[model samples]
Target chain A: MATRGDSAGMNGGGGVLLLLRKDWSIFTLRHRIFVLTVFLMAALQAVVVDEAYFLLGVALAAALAVYVPVIEWYQGTDPMLHSLPVKRGTVVAARHVVTILGMATAGIVWNTTGRILRPILGGGGSDPAFWMTLEGGLTYSLAVAILALLFFPLYFRFGMGRGIAAFAVMTLVLLAVGYGTAQLAAGPAAPGAVGLITPSSVIGSRVDTLLASVGPAATVTVTLAGMAGAFGISIGLSRRWFATREF
Target chain B: MDAVLELRNVCKTYEGFDLRDVSFALPHGYIMGLIGPNGAGKTTLIKMILNLVRPDSGDIRVFGLDAAEQGASVRARIGFVHEQPTFYEGLPAHRVATTVGPFYPAWDEAEFTALAREFGLPLRRKLKTYSHGMRTRFSLAMALAHGAELLLLDEPSSGLDPVFRRDILGRLSAIIAGGNTSVLFSSHLTSDLDRVADYITFLRDGRLEFTLTKDEVLERYALVKGDMSLLTAENRRLFAGIVTGEFGFVALTTNVEQARTALEGQAIVVDRATLEDVVYFTGRTGEGGLRLNGNTR
Candidate 1:
């Protein structure tokens, strides 16, 4: 016969695992489709578009694909989960871990597919081409990882509906600011610079300069720090919000 | 003589209504029924006990543990069946058991399967497809499989048919026969509780009107019917409420023995009050009036 203490520990661990399994089950259809599409798209892009652009597309697609599960995870059904014997903090942590793992797996598939197709579609017999391709993939992964880590916390804190609105408004503001900065950077000489400037180009430029000026090690450290900070803040907010929730 | 559950001045206030200074205790090895009308704060009180909602004032102790401080630990020993069974709609019955079973250390898969079979539940069918009665049975099966020390049921019989309700009550009686467990159930179905509950707690307008043993409730309150001329000022003062018709007067009295002796000559009939009559009488007149279904006197 299991004692009470033994039961508590067993149930706690089992509850988290069971909940994660349920979450993953719901993600099966959408996640698999998104991963497959990303892989195929990355492979095709490698054969046609610039290698840098192919990796960037893969990164962006992987980041956006995460939204499906994140939104589904926080809907009206969560009250059922809260009713279980699991702690609120554990519930929040488990969700974050699941989302992170899903996004990371998608990122890896995108990067690997890009790598395998790059050589076949290269412009010339450039030396150290594989190393250049690896660098581009890593840079894109780091940028996407940071963006996901930041945006996900907002969703967790405010819920899926409000989170989407907040994300859209923020994206629009960033786009406006990015266009304004590009026109200023062009020093009134470049034609249609405002229309030409994209938010991604501005972000890509800043990231490229930081990588060049401070070396890969420093850039990697800063990116990791940013990821950690975003994750930490999101977890804190989620915990507080869930703790006070009447459900 | 440890109390299995205790609620001390537990008060929860909503925008329009308030559960004011509610207090009660259930000793171990007894079944207590929480009876109330619709929107009488039964669910609110249960939610507070489970720590699903915070109480504005008061303390709840379950199994000698502070309910708020040891909520997770307390909940581990509790089996709850809500009015409407809430489960993963997409999951099958067996899957639902698998997901919730591990949460209780004492969860018995064998017992769960047995009860499911006994209730004629289809383990392979998705919960969304189950009928209301079937869903109630599934919830009861899950609640019982874990050997829970304390069972808290909120309107568990609302959608259940008469036969199924009897089955559920019979199972609960058997479960409580072992002398180590207790149950607190809330229902608007007074007859169901009257059949099983040893103790009854009545709530009205978010306050406890009375909490007494079933025998005591029957003993203390009497239904007296006689001519209206028999209702004297002093006799009417002793009784809680009176219904004076053209020919007779019927009233509910707290002191039945005293009323019987005092009005022996004037009273035409005096009978024991059933639990339904008690609930109906209390509900109609918050002052504990007589519910004259017909002019028997």
Candidate 2:
């Protein structure tokens, strides 16, 4: 073999895009049924119950985000990919890009399905205009992002098995804290407010007051921006962590 | 640039094993067989060369470029075939090729298709469905399809039948016929290496026992057989992995000429040593296994 310096095959810089295409080819189309089932469940729940059925959508999207990485992990081929012409950073980039794309696709599916059903279900646009179909999709995404944003970095850092265990622990800790704070906030209110106190009611009342003060658009904008920033940071962290990792 | 691949003082330490101070060079347009027993650091050394594992401290250069610093570019000119099908098992053979083909800028789809057809691979079947021999064939086809200048194969012929093994070895010989591609083949089957390899690097217990040309190994190493009564203290020092049975004694000597001189006119037999004998004796004795008395080291 002559030195590869003069070789025609050493196209530099496009490894990331090449890796993305390969990963997408293997990962996306194979799970068509799962993606369909998520949307189907979201649609059924929305038509049967209420707009708050987005909670189910959020749960579905989060399940997908968590589960997508596991398939590739189970195949145990990522290390072999490292031996290919692609850079390690390119592998990490492709994974993060695929994950984010899956989330965006889920968001689109959630929004599209809700728009189709809202008229039939008679939502009647009761909330502010900003809380329309797209915002609801964004809310669902942000909720999933809360869990997924924590997951990817863990996956890159500790690998799939240990990372999932760590992610579960972190999720449990966050839920316990959220439950405690909700309990404290839902205690009996002062001076004859005359309302049944519940954790969702307390959080909902706080969100209402905040929306009234800042307007729904502003609140959505800030929340989406925060999630975007966190997602960006998570991407950077995953890339760095995966670069030095060994199979 | 004369050597297609080179390693200098490479070292990697795991929980229970360490590949220490491994250094060798593979000249261009030739085949180098990496032969060692199990856990002999054969796979670990190959992984280090491929940059799949990090070395504690060392330099690995491929095609005269640092394997780590110019890793992507270096790898673009190289093709690797793992011992197992660590591929997307759910995807069909054709899809797996499509998934892997584009990374090589010179990847030839027609070449891959031809190889797949030649190997009798069913394109639509998932890799999970393929047998071990089929997967090995698939891996070789993938490795050969892209006009790779260097091929690093880890046990590529492990589970193959005798006919396919000969066919694969013939293909390897044909590829190197052009004097543009080289191969570093790691295998437990020494008979295969004796058939095609121009150079042999024997590693045992994470340390290299010797890296010699085929002629050099054949010329300098020998297998000796004599009566058990001839097992003198001085004669025993020159033998490694000596076997004594009711029939008599059989041992490996790294210095064929010295053994010939020391026991001239005696009732003993000195015969040419095969690659298998070298690996077997050296591996039987583990590291520092050679009792060459500095003649063949």
Candidate 3:
């Protein structure tokens, strides 16, 4: 029944960009009211509390990444997406793109706002030394990326509630691993180490020598490349799992 | 004839229900009513065409391209209204349209605007607030606004009132009258099919009974009524199905001409069958020679 010579009907004009924009639009839809309320709470926490300001923003960013794919799903539009011209792979790709961009945006916006507003609201610059550290930014990015990278495959595999449940279990495992890694990074907490993390700056020269040999730019490149590799693997798994799933 | 869509030996099996080698084609610029009772796999067939549900073994060609492999291209040319139409519910009707419009290359804002006005859709009203009929109208408007080659609708008119149902039927007739679009409308309501369908595809218990021109169905099939004395052994074989009541006996014959010639001068009357008669009779007859599949002659 391969009539019409096989190539007759492939004029697919829409791409992942179309789906990406649609996902972004959901934030402004019904969920925006709730999202704004949460943001105010996070901001108040940042201004009033001495700690958890920047982490609150990163946590919210990760929360959004988990929330977007499930938004239309709850609206009963998930099956509707399969009817659209976009490929399944394309849909998964746009979601991954949204997750990555969403994390970056939420993280940077929080960092910038915290820097400007924390001093104004408190009338003091009790900036923790770690907040002054770019290393803290690296840690924030890792947290954001790790949460998203881990959640998507589970989300694509198990749907929202189950996916989050699976993510919660994995989060516990990751927290344990992160605690172990933090212990290894700690030499001794440096002066004004922000009470959040044991200062990696005080770690002796063996780590510095390794970075020196690798070169700072090369070290940065390897970290980013590692993140990219993790994203690639997660995308592949999501695509494979979603392909056979019928609505 | 260049078919806009075709399915050949399409078989999908699930626990407790299956589409038993169903196959048919919609030639360019005609409406095919996929008529079936509940659980008859009409919706399943429509979903298979959309590639939302993959068939176990079959080939689906749309505009001559393999539907499973070239789904994006094939789906791009199709405008679908699901059994339960879904859109971004939180937004106003207009924004929902805007959000989906980009996916369709031929989407016309002006055409959508006109359709919204014609359907009395309050474009600024949030879609969640609209009634089911309004949502169906919006789905239809969206389906038509895109220059789709094929429209696959599943029970699209069930939610509308009789007045709007007639209005929507007229619109479908007009849409296909342009001679570029074909529709495969799946609905259990045969009266709607009788109104506008050029062809009728009957399904029962996940089996395709027949796909024939509406004219052929009306002309060939007939209803026969007579006294119980007319129920001779030879004459009983003439009827595809028979029902006995207190007053008399009524029967359905697939070939009214044969039944007419066979029963001449007897106390029996044979009249052309309505689409409803055909479905009810054949369904009563159960699974036998009713599977005409699609007429070749």
Could you give the interface RMSD of each candidate, to one decimal?
Answer: 3.6, 5.0, 7.9
Minimum summed lDDT over a 10-residue window in model 3 chain B is located at B288-297
- Candidate 3 local lDDT, residue A15: 60
- The sequence of per-residue lDDT tens digits that candidate 1 reaches over residues A63-177 is 5445444545443445455555667666677766665675566566655655566666763434444224434544555555555555555565566677668867887787678
Q: On a 0 to 1 DockQ scale, where is model 3?
A: 0.28
Candidate 3 local Cα displacement, residue B283, angstroms: 2.8
Give the C-alpha lDDT of model 3.
0.76
Q: What clash count goes with each model? A: 0, 0, 0
Candidate 2 lDDT at A146 equals 52
Give the distance in Å from residue A61's predicted Cα in candidate 2 to where it truly belongs.
Answer: 3.0
User: Candidate 1 lDDT, tens digit per residue, B103-214?
Assistant: 7667788889999999899999988899978888898888888888999999999888898899999988998998878999998998999899999998888989888998
Worst 10 residues of 2 chain B by lDDT: B286-295
Q: What value does DockQ give for candidate 2?
A: 0.39
Candidate 1 vs 2: which has more lDDT: 2
- Residue-wise lDDT of candidate 3 within B61-113, one digit each (tens)? 99999888888788878999988998888788898888887677677888888
Error of 2 at B150 (Å): 0.6
Query: Model 2, stretches more than 4 Å misplaced?
Result: A1-13, A28-30, A38-52, A63-68, A115-136, A177-211, A216-221, B283-297
Model 1, residue B98: displacement in angstroms? 0.9
Per-candidate Cα lDDT values, in order, are 0.72, 0.75, 0.76
Alpha carbon lDDT of residue A20, candidate 2? Answer: 61
Candidate 3 chain A: worst-modelled 10 consecutive residues by lDDT: A1-10
- As for lDDT, the candidate ahead, 2 or 3, is 3
Per-residue accuracy of model 2 over A1-247 as CA lDDT, tens digit each: 2112222332333665666666566665647776687668657655444435555556556655655467678888866777887776666666666666767776667666766776766664454222243445455555555555788788888889998899899977877676666556656563333344322243345445656788888877876786788678777888788766777
- RMSD to truth, every model: 5.3, 5.6, 7.2
